[model samples]
Target: MDITPVANPALDPVQFPRLEEVEYLPVSTKYRGMRLALWGGVQLLVLAICLTPYLIYKFGGEESMATMSAWYWPVGIQAVFSLLWFLEEWKGFPRRGYAVRERDITYRTGWLFRSTTTVPFGMIQHSELSQGPVSRKLGLNHLKLFTAGGSGNLRIAGLEDDEAQALRAIIEARTRR
Candidate 1:
């Protein structure tokens, strides 16, 4: 494999210097509470969906019992998955956070498949702040950074409005410099 350095006039240089250890900043604690409530509500919905067929079979007709019995395995699978999701969400909340350094910003997330992404200031094309309906209700905003790589990019959610703005400012300053 031949790898040579070639300069592109269109692209900026200094895509991040050597990485070193930096203190990570944690996201809002409120988000964990939100996760618990959201996943609990989801499990409740799953419970309803999983049980509906059995209830109908019990009340609707005796012949449909076989059909309902067949659904038991699928229901059991979803229940187990819901349980896993609940546990992962509970355990993963604290693991999520972002760290800003001199040359780049890094974000860490996920439970089962953990990922840590570092986006250099020069590679960052833009940053966006967004709030969905649920997030707005919960008083949280997301700071999404765009770079040359399109997917699996950096997005730090569960930030308070002021904190998100501050982080955005830091990123913008880095990009500008």
Candidate 2:
């Protein structure tokens, strides 16, 4: 995929106008931040679990507990490394985002290894918006664009209902073929 930055700084703040057919799409920073926060929290929990042994041993006594405590530091360090991996994945997400432009539907998605597959309007079998607990809490919904391909479905998350439904209708109408 040929990835190019917009030379025009004006479009930097808002949407970057589609120039030509590109391989990948750009991701929103807001989503990136959320993912980072979520993963970081997870990492913190893992770290805590690893440190519990030592805290228990240190607070408890030298009575048959210090031996278990020796494993704590190693586990904590492993958790830190695991967290780093997650952070790397989160960071790479933005770069994996992509936009699809064709005679059918125009779709965009995140940069990380996510499902941003686009189906031409004609390929769409049906469309709908679904909300999970996390999504509803965040006032976000996922618009699923289904095609005959079944397993290779395309979904756009973090969209308002109006926009999702509108896009769904448009695709359904256009791709009635």
Candidate 3:
């Protein structure tokens, strides 16, 4: 191998074309409400897990009242965390959306730390459509798109089941293998 420098063809590296305009389409309107409910359900489950053990110990007569009081600090911290989680999830719920174009799919997500990802169809390895117990009950499905050499690029949650199926079919038709 030679350690020689090669000459550049273009005079400047920043000669790419500039964008004329930009447009973004939002996800289904029901997505935000569905996400909020899912998060609230998770917080409730976490709350129960946090309090149940201490409640059992206190009411079951396994520990003295004074000893059982030790659970307060831990439970308090968990409650605070659950409240913060609720707030964040609520605020972040409306910030997610996606778009599918001729050659790729774009998903935009996040509130505090935001990101826009575009996955080219030719590079997509495979895709999946799934519904969790809660999402299924809510008539929602999640679409996951996997690229050849990367982790899950698109994981759009809270889509209607039939819409997810249709989108999966479209992308699957464009997938490499």
Candidate RMSDs in order: 6.3, 10.9, 4.8
Question: Tens digit of lDDT per residue, candidate 1, span 42-68?
Answer: 888988888887888778876475787
Structural similarity to truth (TM-score) of each candidate: 0.81, 0.61, 0.69
Ranking by lDDT: 1, 3, 2
- Where model 1 places Cα greater than 4 Å from the true spot, the runs are 1-21, 63-65
The sequence of per-residue lDDT tens digits that candidate 2 reaches over residues 1-177 is 999987854446346544334665443444555566676788778778877777677778753655775876788688778866775666656545435455554444333443435566666778788987765666656777787879757776656556556666666667765
Q: RMSD to the native, candidate 2? A: 10.9
lDDT of 2: 0.62
TM-score of candidate 1 to 2 decimals: 0.81
> At residue 50, what lDDT does model 3 achieve?
75
Off by over 4 Å in 3: 1-22, 53-69, 173-177
Clashes of each: 0, 6, 0
Clashes of 1: 0
Candidate 3 local lDDT, 27-123, one digit each (tens): 6667677766767788788778877878888788787877677778777897898777767666665666777777888887776667778788998
Error of 2 at 143 (Å): 1.8
Report clash pairs, candidate 3.
Answer: none
On the 0 to 100 scale, the lDDT of residue 1 in model 3 is 88
Predicted structure 1: lDDT? 0.83
